[model samples]
Target: MSRRVFFVTCPKGVEYLLADEIQAFGLELVRHSPAGVWAEGDLAAGYRTCLWSRLANRVILHVAEVDAANENALYEGVLGVDWSSHIPGRGSFRVTFLGQNQAIRNTQFGAQRVKDGIVDSFRAAGAQRPSVAPKSPDVAVSARLHRNRLSLGIDLSGHSLHMRGYRTEKGIAPLKENLAAALLYRAGWPEIAAAGGDFVDPMCGSGTLLIEAAMMALDIAPGRRQDGFGFEKWLGHQPEIWLELKQEAERRAHEGKRARVPTFAGFDQDSRVIATAWKNIARAGLEGIVHVEVRPVESFTRGEKWSQRGLVLTNPPYGERLSERRELSTLYEALGETVKSAVPGWRMAVFTGAPEFGKSIGLRSFKQYKLFNGKLPAQLLLFEVDEANAMTPRDPDRSGEIRPRIANEERASMLRNRLKKNLKTLGQWARKQGIGCYRVYDADMPEYALAIDLYEGRVHVQEYAAPKTVDERAARERLAEALAVIPEVLGIDPADLICKQRQRQAGTQQYEKQSATGEFMTVHEYGCALRVNLKDYLDTGLFLDHRPVRYWIQTHAKGQRFLNLFCYTGAASVHAAVGGASRSLSLDMSKTYVNWARENLALNGADSGKHRVEQADCLAWLAEKPSPDQRYDLIFMDPPTFSNSARMQGVLDIQKDHATLIRQAMRRLTSDGLLIFSNNFRRFRLDETLQSEFSVEEVSKSTIDRDFQRNPKIHRCWHIRHLS
Candidate 1:
């Protein structure tokens, strides 16, 4: 039992956590590294680390550390090791080399050289030369060459500790076992479990955390369930000691499981994954102990058996695997709601790569840890689920509570300068074009996420919701600064500056009115008067982005019959009527917007009998078979990204139903008619079925103004017409 050093490999960013874990296990941690940690320990200490340390990816007993600056030095260094003591005579072995220097090059070449050195060492000795086994080998040798220094060790754990030998099936983007354990450890789950506390993972996919929690609760050694380790094939292996350690662990596991183990449960929205979780649970040998069921986060209310004021932990999926990343925004928020409503007063830890999504979860996380899930960087959002923290002015993300900066600080000054620069340039361009409404600042600085548009004398500031990675506090502060600075930069009164947080909206929610102030302000756009309300809604009366499209409609509206469908506030209809359209029909489901459109028309002096506004489901109106005389020469159809209003028949997925909606509009078109179809769904694809029946062309690029240049797909516009 000579004094020896060990190199324990762990995931990046958790080096300190691993160092603390090794120290807590009574092993003397010598130093820390980015990839792993260096520690002083004997054979038992190394063995114990493999048996107990959960944060470690692999426990490597330090065999040698040498300066292998060149390939010759590397060969000699590895050959110097007593290969006979570790690698058996001519037995199968795998060499895994990590990191690289200028001399060693790629991992494959380094691995080859290490293997050759091991074989040449054996040949130089009387022992049999070892053969290479890439997949599974008798012994696993870990090697590293960084800064011309080589550190080598025999991997005591056969597999990376994350394997745990229970997960036969995994859900999409499953959290690795060690990382899951690290999250739990960081959240102080072990202490909670030790004190007979309960465990819960509401969005537990495939039950990794629940199984890990159960193992921790029942004092089950992770290696106890594993098949084998690298030491099993090593010549210096002590079978009796290994057997004794495992047997002791097995005894503790049986006793703990048989006796009072903390109550734990897992829940998932998908029943199939719940079954997978159950199978995973059974494989982890916690079949009867941990309960799992199919339940959404919204239903994760307090339960009698499992809700004993313990940690409600989960790694809810974020934007990575999902095609529509925006959809995850609501999912994270629902989990937060579940915590606030169901598990109040309990401890909560939400591990998500996208932390901005956590904002929707409403409950503010007091502490956050930077951790990695494989290669993806993530955060473990820790919150003390106190009901008092759920809703209050103190809630960090609540609109009322702000950390405003008023242009004095350097960062604030930098933002103000950028805004001033944009305003001077785009502002002059707007005045030259006789454009009363235009963008001044479009997130020119990353810190400032506000989209500032100058509407006549008023300023409309829409703050883009911060991503999960940005600290909520940082987002709030930047938002506050933007809110404070926009009016001053625009030379507008602070009262005239309207601020709104723009979040990801789905279906009709995007078009859904934010308020009912019924307030209106008359604004001039390209000489045509329009009514815009800076308050009471996400959008002002005029969509500044679609200024060019409205102008295009107005220029082409003279003496032509116009039809506006799903027309919100009838800005386009008003523009067309002002352009002298012979007749126009404005159709909308919301009577409020129809009334608003009427006001916009009246403000422009185009509220005449020739222009009519109708409050009806636009989809139903389009469905009706119109008389031949009802055909229009010009149609303006801008449908919502999605809609399921009770007034409508079914959900309107713009991407899915665009063809039907377009064809229906074309059905009421004159023999040679033009339909301007547009939508704000960024992912919307125009249907090609009508390409044969109509001349379809996306005029989005030409119609997009300077204000919306950052996102060209802000709203896609197409000039479609009957081929005839």
Candidate 2:
């Protein structure tokens, strides 16, 4: 038996799992790579792996490796290969080429060249050219190029091995068969089944895990259930040997099915999906082996006395949107409760996309296996369900400890260190530039939930609203610790320090005065003077994060007309006016803030006639009146995440209304003008249509100051210009 190199592809992050599965077949020579594994084995070894290996996407047999720098080189190299021996003349084939080079940037083009090379090789050898059959090819060729080197192989498995033939019916976001098998392998399902233990998937969408686990326990060959494999149609395939393997597999499957199998059950809350799971199980010929039923998390109960200890596995929904987090938090907490109350001393493998949700489950895990569910980076948390992991002392003081916690103290120490480190660097930069207002801390410590800044000599502190689950007394103590640390940390007096808590503000709540202290501190940024109100507003008159953006406006404002939309306090307008802009107009819904913007302009000594402020809902203003006919050469538009104001006709959602806003804004821009659009919403996504409508370039990195280096996503800024 002569050995040959074989490439087995799997999902990204599952290379180690696939390598382990391949090595189990005694292939001794297995190397793992991104999204796949490489192995060296004989024909029988390859066949056996294709039949038994569960975590592989495709088993490709290496034919030749070529040096191809361009498409022509690629075609010549492919033509040099003897295709007649690999496939008969007129054999229908399809080529799957991956990667790109200087000359070939498209996979479709590379695939076409490879197909041409194969056909030319057959025709050049005086044989009839093979037909191309993308639908159902007789021979499937795989090619990939990296650094001018190409690796060509013939597919031994017809389609991806993840299509294990049992799942003709699938639910939304259903787990692929190979991924499900990998989860079971990581959870020690085979070992548990070997010990007469059972298996359960509490949230099984369509019983993918149940069928795969049952197959693994019964030693059933995946290829046996599959209709046809690519090798069966290959010219190099040995029919006699394949027949023997098939017979042997059938006999083993029949015997394995009759053996003592582990009790397996799948439960889903959706009754509709339960029927689909049963249909898929029967399709896989596991009629009485795997049971499925409709069961909610709240109704889950411990298994009967005979089957109590085994593996509980599930792939629960991980909320990908911010709005879904609150609801999904409850779901995860409920899942944790169900698993804890139903099965103790059992091993559980919970796959979730959000690692934070794992903490809500109230159970701690000993190990986490990195895996991928499609393109999303995911984790397989292996938890040992017991009293030691989930239960502990709940406040020895009985009334929830109100003093400084050791954990919070340690975190505060770390935050202090981080702040000092940042100040040593940013403070020097700020002083060198003659700037007196900047951020010293932007949530350096997650537990502290505060951002500290320097307003002239005053230390302004902001505390984020704590979740309802947090103890109020403890939150206050933590706040006290932060307050005590800030003044001492910056050598500022306590009397000059201002502390405020940030809550959800809608409409004019941000503008309404919190106090009657109309005291405004004059601050200097980039040689421009501004007034900041620390006592009476949720935000200081100036946003420290947009300092660079303001400076950018200053540099680009010379001899250009500038307009600022949804402008808060008109920092950008002031910068534009300071830069000698011909004229500037700033708009905002807050009349109080509009007055503040004018004060900022006056403090800078910019012309009152050239710089003006308007109080209006920006969306309504844009739609209600036509712009002064493309007058502005420079504009800045940064909207809120969500706002519902009594002054507006309807609510404004940045993501939903950005397209219309930008289109209307574009109508007001000069032919040679630029628009700087920015927002601080972390999850904001720009409208795709804007990509073609404007010459858009991301300017977030270029405009980020040193203070925001660690938190680049704090704001998203883009520079948009008219297409020439």
Candidate 3:
């Protein structure tokens, strides 16, 4: 039947491209709107459009268009349409309404009226009326009420096309496959391929980008692998025409030149993600073109001439999953430097939901495109290699100009003056404690530009400010006035210090005020063990508060199997292993810290096999088999106070889940196993009545650190014993 069907749809920013795709299916565009183009075609054409259009969300095929001045007219006009031809004989049907007008002020009311009109039309035809189905429907009707006019249509696409059916493996915050493809198209990949440039994603999670790039480069249609589409079940289904289209699509795909072998590569630091990427690459049937590898971004090396005009596209992880904000920030900074230093003239695109966080990379963007990543508005920031605009050299220009040496002498003069005045007060305090550590004095008094940290044999200094604060400038001036005799503050070198302005989370509306340094600083204490300077680490770095429990392990660890849960840098494991434990198992979700724990074991030269580290979801792993040995004498569990990393199974609110977690740990304990449960949630109160399975004791006092004399409520530790 000849029908004036107006198709209602929205294209993803690329409207002209989608328009070209739609016209390819033999549909005629009669009119166009901002949201969609009005097209005239038969029900068959509508069905074909829905089944084949990869970019469209839902296809609404116009049933009837009528002018309705008011609500009653809208209902009656809709009822006049031939409902039997559009709807199924006896299956479910629904009316969904949208738009604004007086004829139907509320969408809910408009939908009800349309449903009633359809039901009335069916009833008048002497057929058992099909019931309204709220969820899925055999025949779904859409009603648009706008400007006192009513336009009704039938849904030809039952489900969104983004669900490509190949995404069996999902990591935290995975990008939609279609969306990833759209991003590649937007980033000028089509032209990049023509220019002989390659594509590389260092942080490729699941190989989505690499797969999409390969598919597009080889002219492979995304829908080639789908099992079914809504049009297959339609009354006007054209099997012959659909098969012809499919054959043509495959024919065109075969004629196209494939992407250069090894031109597309994806790397992920995680082994599991690399495996998932390989599976996805295989699923796309592009294993020959796309390569997946397990390697850190820092380890990525570009062969000679391979980097020229290359495209480095990466979606560096946001701090949301990895709470190591400080380290990630430094890592991003290193990445930017690597890009500038190593890959000169190469182009780059970084897709991130949080643009402000991108500042940590230290690279300025040239172009940014707003894109929707599944309701999350993200920016695909494009950066170019313009070396001329990069950061200036640290040293000022001294071109043919001779400045007074007294300025250097003046800096020395200032340092001496400051030391002389504060010598007995702060200096005596520092010297009495074996003055090897770098004495951090502001370089410029009013400028407040510098801070120096001393180590036993080496010094670590950092410039705190550039122009310098008034306090720093004044401090420097004061030093110049007093410590002139101190011989230029000898024995300190400038290279040992690190300096940068404080960073803040970018793109965040709330919590933008948070410090850039992060809430904690985790460091390796011995060779492989991690220690946090909690006081400096947003709170307390090293949990000196865990001393008593560590001491307990020293006594009970002999000839026992020790399991340190949520082992941060394996500090507790080090204590257990050092205490002569026969075997120790440390479980942490962070690979970074797991490696750190391995280092700790190597430092002590402990039996290598005796210390094992596993990176997995601690709760899920624990819920599985307990150690078959049932031989744990020291088991420590101290979870973070609170965190919301995407790596975690779910948000961990320690106060609410501590008791349950502790109870589970006790299950993994041997008959005489000691389950040490500790947390830094200061306001926490123990669940004194935990099922009577174990005896609990507060070991709060044992956590005290000898070095930390100021405000020692760093963390609270407890020991649990199961009495057989």
Best model number under TM-score: 1
Q: In candidate 1, what are the lDDT values of residues 362-442, reduced to their tens digit?
A: 666789998878777789988888766674222344555354465347888898888888888888888888888888777
Error of 1 at 341 (Å): 5.1
Candidate 1 yields a Cα-based lDDT of 0.79
Lowest lDDT sum, 10 consecutive residues, model 3, at 533-542
RMSD of each: 9.8, 11.1, 13.1
lDDT: the better of candidates 1 and 3: 1
> lDDT by residue for model 2 over 1-724, one digit each (tens)?
7888999999888788788788776455567778888899877777777788888889899999987888788889999999888886867999998988787889998899999999999878889998999988999999988779889998999799988787775223358888999999999998988888888888886888999999988989877888888888888888877787889889988999888878788887766567889988998899998999887776778757436669999988643223233345556677778888888878888898766566667788799887878877788998888879994312224453233234466767876787788779989988997778888887776667777889878988877656545786677777777776677778888888898753322223323655678898888888788888888776677888889999999988999899999898888898899898999989999788898899889888888788889898898787865646536899999887655445665556566567788888888888889999988766567877789989999888988888777677878899988999
Per-candidate clashes come to 5, 0, 47
Which residue segments of model 2 deviate by more than 4 Å? 321-323, 392-724
Residue 714, candidate 2: how far off, in angstroms?
12
lDDT of each: 0.79, 0.80, 0.62
lDDT, candidate 2, equals 0.80
Local accuracy of candidate 3 as per-residue lDDT tens digits, 30-56: 766654677777655665566456556
